[model samples]
Target: MTSSGTHTVDAVVVGAGHNGLVAANLLADAGWEVVVLEATGAPGGAVRSAEVTAPGYLSDLYSSFYPLGYASPVLRGLDLARYGLSWRHAPDVLAHLMPDGQAAVINRDPEVTAASLEAFAPGDGDRWLHAYADWQQVAEPMMTAITTPFPPVRGGLSLLRRLRTAGALRLARRLVVPVRKLGDELFDGAGGPTLLAGCALHTDLAPEEAGSGVYGWLLAMLGQQIGWPVPVGGAQQITDALVARLTARGGRISYHARVDRVLTARGRAMGARTVDGSLWRARRAVLADVPAPALYLDLVGAAVLPPRLVEDLAHFRWDGSTLKVDWALSAPVPWTNRAVATAGTVHLGADLDGLTGYAAALARSELPRDPFLLVGQMTTADPEHSPPGTESLWAYTHLPFRRDWRADEIAEHVTRMEQVLEDAAPGFRQLVVGRHVAGPADLERENPSLVGGALGGGTAAAYQQLFLRPIPGLGRADTPVDRLYLASASAHPGGGVHGAPGANAARAALARDRALTGAAYARLISTANRALYP
Candidate 1:
């Protein structure tokens, strides 16, 4: 019999973000009773949308484009389209504007995309196609390797078998090549390298950073393969689809229920106790879809962790924050470069030099005088995002991490950003009918996971990726804490709307449950460690 304010479920998932909901859905499908708790009144976490500026204009409060969202196997497997989640692909994927009033665009057609590069350099058209062909040879197996748990026995071996000896070595070298170097090696023109550099800037990595090339290549290929698509009704449609599926499967979710502490007994997690003093017991596992720092330091407390692990947590670095501006425009942006008018996503900050400067300034903990902007023209992707003729647009720039953020300072930065846009599109400011600004503080206030608005969950630096993610260990979804798992953006395949972390975490938990009993338990635990992959 359960006591008042106490309930028992096979699993308790803390947080209702995409990953958390995915974990809950999988667990419930496996016949485990699952309950999810969210701190906010709504379920999506940062994947939310609202008419913050005006009644008819829909704005994605945080994340907008879904190149990864459209490609996520976990999401695709769930068949979200049947749940009313329709994606709107842009006319062209992305465009990197050049200083001379021209732009490099990424088209879905391989021939067309390469042709844009060919116009700039003599043989670049062929080179771009050749490079994409090389990527296609390894893309599927490589993506499988990335999305699966570390030491991906199946996926990794498959990739290796495909790459063989020479190809394997070349693949390794390519992973660590800087964006600038990759550009310099591939094409002689500014357009190709500049486009890659802009994608690299999507993360906190500088142009010169090793492994920055991977981000550029990954996004570029993904954009080319599946255009940067967004949900028709805004990002919230994604959350609604996941929730619709989860609840349909008998999983439960309680919003505004913050888990204050992980309940432990006999050195294993039992469940969690909420701030409202509700005790929810988990018969199977407790999966936390929050940041590593929040899980270890805040919820679990430092006393429970090994001193060395706790010390390592102290050194864990986060990526730069964001300063975002959303607008309900009276008319579409009038671009100096007419090519940019039709682009779904437009990048500003010119070329490699400008991007490098923006990155360097952030690294030095100083605000950039000329910040790089990632602009999402919502109406370009989905006309329903705004009223008929008017447009809905958003631009975001990265900022250094900070403990101090003032409103006045935020406004000043906003003004500077508008100025930057004005240079690219002379009448940009005049088109703004309604505007909403979310600096680091505003971002944190909306979603705690955004910790300084580091959107990728944490730094995506090479040292922080793969097995070293969140913290150094085997990159399984399982944590050192028994019966508990870290199944969020902080986990493997760090950040993005992909549900790999959740699926992987649930798989790890289920595998552990099926382990041998008594005498053979030790051996099963060893198998369970590597068997965490899907």
Candidate 2:
């Protein structure tokens, strides 16, 4: 992929996902020459799109929602709108359906959302509103803390300053509390708790696991401020915008150029070598948007890693595997309730207990007879996603890794999911004109980073979180290798389309470069500041 043989750049980024693109764009903005290498023919790894079902129906292959994208300050800096990237949102964010044919809907207005919650219990509405008000105080701080360095000392100190001692402790406990328990402790009805647990499914974490409630609460609040918006055309627009920015700044991105090994000399990263014997020589650094195990075990070689880190990789637990089905229907889903059809995202689990049961099934490595589904009606968010009166939608659920999928097994899974929806919305399958099923195997074939279909980087368990993501004492984007960094979801803050990991890696690389450039520059700046100010 070297247009010029033996090419050189200030930095070489491996994997052209959103994270890698972010680092590449930022480096180029600083006037540093950068090159991005992608394994696939096109960019936007998981954040990709295709017309899988019908001719005119546009289906998002992996991700469909972008609440984090809308709320991200890092992405806000980009003029994505100028690059033909517009966002579309549903009038209502989501709904959690119940077995009793009742549903709790999340509306844009806090007052309206809270009032709706009162349908479950007389006083639940006020509690939901008040709890959300409390959540706002720490939402920014929590985002800051997780997205920053390992200890997140500065973000933590700022949060402490705002929450004080008692307030801080309470908030910490609230975030760590399991979603299933949180709802029971805080509300008297199934609506509020079901809503929170539905959010927990965004990750692989079970509703009963600690830190699961944080996602439910965090996503709900963000949905209030910003609906789960989607790119106007498709998720591909995001990749297009990032690639446009990178190329406009004189950076290069090479596709189908798979990196074979990270070239290191004298315990320092020099660059990388592709499988085709193409060597990309980096002058300043190399940043990788890959999983920890892949980076350490495959690319860098296990011989170079510390013994403890090698051991940590052994115990690394992946999130539950996923089974996704996309459909191009002749008409919108005939939700018997009629209300659930209005939301962009819909939780298809029967009730709160149904969600917890799905989680329980995962913990036991068994397929749930009643799988919890996260269904998306793209046309609900943007009519342009499909033809007039038709729908391009998808439904995703989790399966334990033990049940390795075969072609027949995948077909069975798809049928089960359709039946589940049909139970709630009769004649649902009658509307399907075309269908595409992505089992765990198909997902891995589409994106290797998904590795056995584990989404959300890795398991967001209590032990594997904070300073222990990927491995213990290795949460920072900077790796032990000099001039090398982990800029992927496997690093701190884990997965999501947020691009925080990439931003952190870019900042880390710049800081390391300044330090490596020599202490003379550092001392000169210190002395100059003193002379000018003091």
Which ranges of candidate 2 are over 4 A from the true structure? 1-5, 515-534
lDDT of 1 by residue, 1-534 (tens): 112398899999999988999899889889898999888788888799999877798999999998877887778888988889999887888999876766888988888889889888988888888888888998888777777778777877887899898998998898999999998998888888998889988888998999999889888988888888999989999999999988888998987888899988765789998888999999889999999899888888887666766877887888888999999998888888877887789998657898888888999999998888999999888998898888899999999988478888789899988987899999888888899999888887788788987788789898888888887766778776778889888888888888888888888788767646522533454455444321
Candidate 2 lDDT over 133-218, as tens digits, reads 88677777777776676778877998899999999898789779998888888799889998988988888888888899888888
lDDT of 2 at 380: 88
lDDT for each candidate structure: 0.85, 0.84
TM-score of each: 0.96, 0.95
Runs with alpha carbons beyond 4 Å of true place in candidate 1: 1-4, 515-534
